[model samples]
Target: MLIGGGHSHVAVLRRFGMRPMAGVRLTLISRQAETPYSGMLPGVIAGHYTRGEAHIDLRPLARFAGARTIVDEAVGLDPRARQVLFATRPPIGFDVLSINVGSTPDVSVPGAEGAVTPVKPIDRLLERWRAVEARLLASDSPCTVAVVGGGAGGVELLLAIEWRVRHQLAAAGRGAGHIRYGLFTDSAHVLPTHHARVRRAFARTLAERGITVHAGSAVVKVEPGCLHTADGRSHRVDEVFWTTQARAAAWLRDSGLSVDDRGFVRVGDTLESVSHPGIFAAGDVAAVDPHPRPKSGVFAVRQGRPLTENLRAALAGRARRGFRPQRRFLSLISTGDQHAVASRGPFALEGRWVWRWKDRIDRAFMRQYTELPPMRAAAPDAAPADEMAAPGQVPDASMRCGGCGSKVGASVLDRVLTRVKQPAAGRVVIGLDAADDAAVAEVPPGRLLVQTVDFFRELVSDPWVFGQIAASHALGDLHAMGARPATALAIVTVPYGIESKMEETLTHLLAGAVAVFDREGVVLAGGHTSEGAELALGFAVSGDVAPDGVLRKGGLRPGDCLILTKPLGTGTLFAADMRGRARGRWIDEAVASMLLSNGPAAAAFIAHGVSACTDVTGFGLAGHALEMARASGVGVELDLSALPLLPGADETLRQGLVSSLHSQNARAADAIANAARHAGDLRFAALFDPQTAGGLLAGVSCAGAEGCVAQLRAAGYPSAAIVGRVTPGEDGERWRLKIGD
Candidate 1:
């Protein structure tokens, strides 16, 4: 599995998707659904391109690669166990793992937290840009902007913001000089990392734009609306953008891998982690080679080929090849507007045409991902008998079976478990074994058995990722009941395939499932399997909860706050996935959200006196909410605007795309109190989009609702929100659901 959808990994995914290695399953894990390429970001800011044009569509890429993309942060790593742990979901197991999580600006500088905004993690920078634009548009007075750091990123951002703001001002019938731009650098010149000739060109460009250049002035501290320099001088500013000292993500330091002082993963020429051979690091997160190289996107881009080769070699149990990175590369710096400066060693060129060249190069790079090659039919010699089997004997590619009919073969399941080292405990009675039909466990007296089963087909193509989401989905039921999962017996169905392919699929799928089970203190006991035409997975999980600790679905009382742990919309995106229309990033986001188990949310809910809860799954939010309402004997009033949606879901719905189960889900809307009153709202229509491994919808007491929501958000469930409220039921019959504006 590939972790972090940064620029370099994107290239690797494109290459692998175009022509995948047989017996290898590719999976990508990222924190964001859409990964913005830095090369086109300045143009986006300068209004040369729209967001869609500049941003890569990760969903299609994932589809093309036949990879499952998970959108979540990797919080920890167990190289010894070959498992990657996420903050809110199950651990992911990988035979060969690669990291391309790009660097972020150093935010550890004194007063840096609130005084200045860092421009790395392009998404946050874009958000800050929007806020700055709003402030500028809201005022008639002049605005001052300061960019700290003399590097290319800082210079480019400063110029881009200047050009965009000025053009916008002129269009508004205002003076172009209404905004002031300043560049601060510790070095004696701007573009300090580049050649002298390149620096001179940028220096001249800054002067021409009437921008103030403060060289040899390191920002020691940042104050409200101002920067304090080491020279003991302060520069007043309306906003401060920090693009200095790019560093690795802090999580990497604690990941138990060998890292340099700067916290970047230490790798040899082979790009394999010096400490962990099974794990590899690349892109900005890696410290490369025989000679130290500056952190640049160029190196990351170049490393894609070698990284892919090494991963394949490692998986095949073959010797890995070393990657000899080039010592120097050409640099292209944008000067806002449609102008750029190019540097190759000592030679420097600046003009509008240079920008055009840069644009062409960047677009060419993006095209590698956006435009994919068509899948070719197998050659006559390579085609298997099954491919040419008679009509009655051959399985249809479409219209897959549901339920237990779609499971992995028993033989394949047996082989995968041979690799896993089960934890040994006398008390841990239930565990994976060859002869057991059902997991047998010895529960202590006074502990009640909490049993729940959840199953679903592959919403995504990647088996490893499907495994994670399936595990998380199944565990949600246990979590909602405030139970500690003890053991799980997996039920997996893999598509009919050759022995090699079947083994590979089962390995990744079980690895993913087992990773989650391990983290939740659940043991993987034996379960049944069979061959099928499609991939599906589930777990029969048993948990333990104190007699009084069980939270039931019918205990919800009137005046309770309804809190949703994660956003919705996996079903719609996956529906789009079948048509090859969903963007890679969109699918990535959906998978990430689904893979997030409701464990944390459930824990928080129980701690805050949650009365009742249920996970939103195959049923749409409205359908699930109705179930809660019916069970609790109460009425629910949901604020449409308060609903949290997965990114890109609204666009998919606007495009008239929906899951296959949507119609059935929509039929359940009959239970909604005002279904006809606001039938025209597109947002309301999305209430019927079936979610996969969705969030926990809980009804908590009003007294602790605010604090519970806050705690959930701080726990990395940023989309967690109080979506609705529980009210007294009208009659003896179950309940009602209302959509409020």
Candidate 2:
């Protein structure tokens, strides 16, 4: 699975989606649904385009490519096990893994924590923009905005905001001078890193916009309402945006991967991670050598084709080709007003038409994925001239089967096990490859039996991500039951491949699964492996939930408040993901949500007086909630607006997107009190959206609901919330999903 849906990886996803590798499964893990294109962000901020116009949809890309999508952040890597562990969900196994998380702004500067918002992540910057805009709209006063760093990003952003604020003011019948903009840099001039001609253009633009440019001024501290410079100069500001020095994500430095001084992954020309051949790095997250290039989206975009090629080769155990980056690339910098400056080497040009050219290039790149070519239909077979032919073309083939039906065929499993030796054991009664119905274990008199089984097909294509989700999903059963996991038996199946390919596939998958088990004090008990046409995993786990304090699904009571530990919508998101229509940031957000295990949430639920609970999985909120309500002989009134949905879930549903399993889930909504009333609401549809490695749905007392949610959020389950309440059942049959006011 590709981790971090940044620019480079988005390109890789699109290319792979168009023409996938025959036997390879692709998955993408990201923290956001829409990854903003840096090149168009200024245009967006300047009001020339909307947010959607500047972002790439990762969900549709994954769907179109038949890849799985895991929305999560990778926490660590177990190279030996070929697994990537996430903070939330299970560890993901992969034959090949790639990282393109991109860089974070250097917010480590003094006093930056409270004073400035970093622009590197893009999301934070958008939020800051909202806050600034709101404040300006709330009063008839001028707003002062300060931007740190005088590089291309900083200059462009300052101008964009200036133009947007002024435009908004004029639209509101206010004076254009209602907003003040400033740019600060620890350099002799603005755009110090660019050519003199480029610098001159930016200087002229800033002057025309009446933006104050502070050169040779080093910021020492960021105060609440002002930035204090090293020379004891303080500039008052309503909002401070960070666009200064950029660096790799902090997690990369300790990930055991080879990194440069700035902590970016060190990669060769082929974009392979320096220390691990099976791992690759690209985009702003990677530092390429032989020609040290600046951290620009251009290089990341160019590297996508070669990176995808090398990943396929690496997985196939073949020699990989190198990526050759252009020595010089055209730089088209927007002026936030339908005009732009173009620079090639030392040469330069500027005009409104240049901006139009830049716009066409950016839009065309986006269209390649959005407006995909339809798959060509197979030709009809020849028959006698008199034979009648159908007037219309045949319907496209049905999508591949999913769930249990997608399991590996029996013959393929047996053949692979025949060549492997079994582990030696004295007391072992059941062994892998024995074709037994259930695993057999010896139970001593004093020891109690703890059993948990987890099964799920690939939700995403990236091996590492699939490994994480699989492991996390397996571990959830143990955590839910309050068990200290003892050991795990993995049942993994990969697409058929050569010996080396099989080895790599098994290695990465086990690595990811093992990493999760290892962290939970569990051992890898011997299990089975086989080849199939798709990837799937199941774990028969044993753990010790204290005999005196076992948590079960049938413990809820009336008068309890319902709490959800994480956001919903993996099903709808993944459905959209398949079409390559979901945005990168949305996929990222989904994966992050999935990777988050219910371990912590479970503990908090129990401690906070949780009466009953169940992890929200394939059946979704309404389906699972119905289960709890029926089991407890109580009725639930779910506040639809209170639902914590994954990013882009509502939008996707509004667009009529849904998971393959959504129909079955919607059928289960018959238990709902007024399903028809919410039949047309997109937000309500998400109530039936199937989830994988989702959150925990708990029932707590109404009085403790707010406090419990606060505690959960404080304990790191930030998305936790009180989604509804339980009450005495009306006729003891109906569960209601109320769209609250």
Candidate 3:
């Protein structure tokens, strides 16, 4: 498992993508989706490069590497249990772990936390910078901006800010003289780690730009708009930026791994943790004990290949190779406006050409991960034994059994069931609590039975999350029929693995499903589990409904309003995710949408006296809507512009990224009256985008439509909207759908 999306780890992903290992499941746990390229960060600040151009998108890179990504912060580690703890969710187990989370800016100075913006976490820095820019654009009086650090990062950043802000001001009809810049450092000279010639070059450049340099001045304290120096002098400033010494996360010191005094992991020459086997560290979060070097992005970038090689060896149970640090490396410092200085050893050069050279190098490095090469199909190979087989066992398909022999071991299933909490007993007569051949359930005398079944392979890597989605999706059918769910039987298929591994997987999957069942008052009756080539889950759900209260697709009335209880786009989003084209935030939002239960929305619709209702699922909105129109024997007119969309859906569809089921669902478009005229719009594609655990589409009385939607939004269906209205059935136009503006 990779712990962060840092410079080194991105390279590792690229290399792994080019050459993958069978049976090795890779997972990345990161706090953010995009990681900034520190070398090009100053260029971004100077407006020479856009933020997108300076950051690496990790979602696609992980996909290309065939790795699962968890966009969460890692808070702790359990080396004893071989698990990594997160800020949320259960701890994830790993066979091998690597850390490249990078370092944070030292913010221990008095009042620094609330007063100054730290420039280490590039995402946070960018957010704060945007706010600072807005304030600067609105200010008319003179303003002072101070950078607290004399290192190369601080110097280059201050100059970049000055250039970009001054240009923005000039374009807004303001004078550059209204802004003042200051550079403070505890050291006597800027670029203290660089050669004397490099320092001289930057010092001259600063003086030429009229930037005040307060060398040997340490920031003792900071207030809202002022800072105190160690020399007993107070400096008034409108903003303060901190780019001081890098610091490790405090959790590292307590993580039980050998760490230095500064909380950085102490790693050997092979980049493996000195205190723990199968654990590796790289980037600013690691301290190389054999050959110590300063914390710099260059070192991080250089460490990529070696780290990958060592990690691959570790996983294969081979010896790790040592990596030696270079004595000197090239450094390019940008001077804010397409000009830069290059220095190596004692030599220095300055010109616009240097900046161009730097840009080429930076962009080339980013393209390896961003503009990925096409992936070739995997070759037929032997089943992997690393994670699949236990001691003294081998993975061989010929040795596997058929029929009842394919079922999971009775002992394993019993243990997993014991570990997973069973849902509270409901209408279930002889369910999991009893050892019965079949589940028996009873229905109320006054209510009719509403039965629905749904099954699908996992769309996500997290089994727990997948379980929630599967249960929610299955329940959607009953909710659309306005029934109260009572009992469910789960069908599970897990990949062939060791008994212990299979047990753990079953426990998590059952636990996730049971959580949803307990909340919805549904009982988990008995189910079946068997070994398979991959993981899959499903449920057979049964519910109760009043004989006359059943909501169906045939009750639409003329002039009724159409309300969608959730946003569209799970189909396209997950499709894009598989192809490595979707952003992490987009997938995160989509998962959240899928996990939402349709129970509340169905209740709201019942209360609002809906005429027709059906939950949109595998069939896209177009197919489902057509089903409603055909059943009601009416022609439906849908306002194309009014349809609600999930975030990133439009862009993905525009890029032509769609699910495999998309083409099948689009056949429903043939029933549209004017498909040819509106097919060009990207929103038109959304009409046929298949969804999982999608929202309910309901027709309500025009008088109650507005209130129904308002209440749905208040009940957590924020995207619920009036997408269209029911129209009168035309004799020859039965099942017809109209697309309108």
Compare the candidates by TM-score and give the number of the best one. Answer: 3
Ranking by lDDT: 3, 1, 2
Structural similarity to truth (TM-score) of each candidate: 0.66, 0.66, 0.92
* Per-residue lDDT of model 3, residues 1-741, tens digit only: 999999899999888888887767788888887888999999888889999899888888888887777777999988878888866355677888999999988999989997788997888888899888888888778889999999889999999998899889888888778788999999999999888999999999998887999999999988878889999999999989999998899888888999998899999999999999999999999999998998999999999999999999998899999999897989999989889999898999999999999999999988887898875554111235234345555356457776788798899888877766575477888888785999999998999999989989978866777888899999999999999999888899887776666776787687778778888999888888988777899999999999999999999988999999989999999998877788877888998999899999999999999999999998899999999998998888898888899999999999999999999999988899889999899989999999999999999998999999999999999999998888885776777999865
lDDT of 3 at 89: 51
Each prediction's total of clashing residue pairs, residues at least 3 apart in sequence or on different chains, is: 13, 66, 0
Q: Model 1, residue 498: displacement in angstroms?
A: 15
> Which structure among the candidates has the greatest lDDT?
3
CA lDDT of 55 in candidate 2?
A: 81
Off by over 4 Å in 1: 176-178, 375-454, 461-535, 538-572, 588-741
Q: Tens digit of lDDT per residue, candidate 2, span 1-741?
A: 788888778878777766666546676777765678888899988889888888877666656655666656787777767777778444666778999998977887777986688896797788788888778766877678889999888888888888887778788888767678889999999977678998898899899999999999878888788888878898888889888877987777877888999999998998988788888999888988655888889988888889888987886679999877998889998888889999888978999998999999999887876676553231011111112213332111133245665444455444434423234242346655354665565554455567877776766665556766787877776776766666678888765444334454565566666656556655555666655555688788876655666776777777888899888889988887665557667777787787786788888888887788788888888888888877776778888877888888988998888988899898866777677788787778888898888888888888888888888898788889888878776664444444444
Candidate 1: C-alpha lDDT = 0.80
- Output the better candidate (2/3) by TM-score: 3
Q: What's every prediction's RMSD, in angstroms? A: 8.5, 9.5, 3.0
For lDDT, candidate 2 versus 3, the one ahead is: 3
Give the TM-score (vs. native) of candidate 3: 0.92
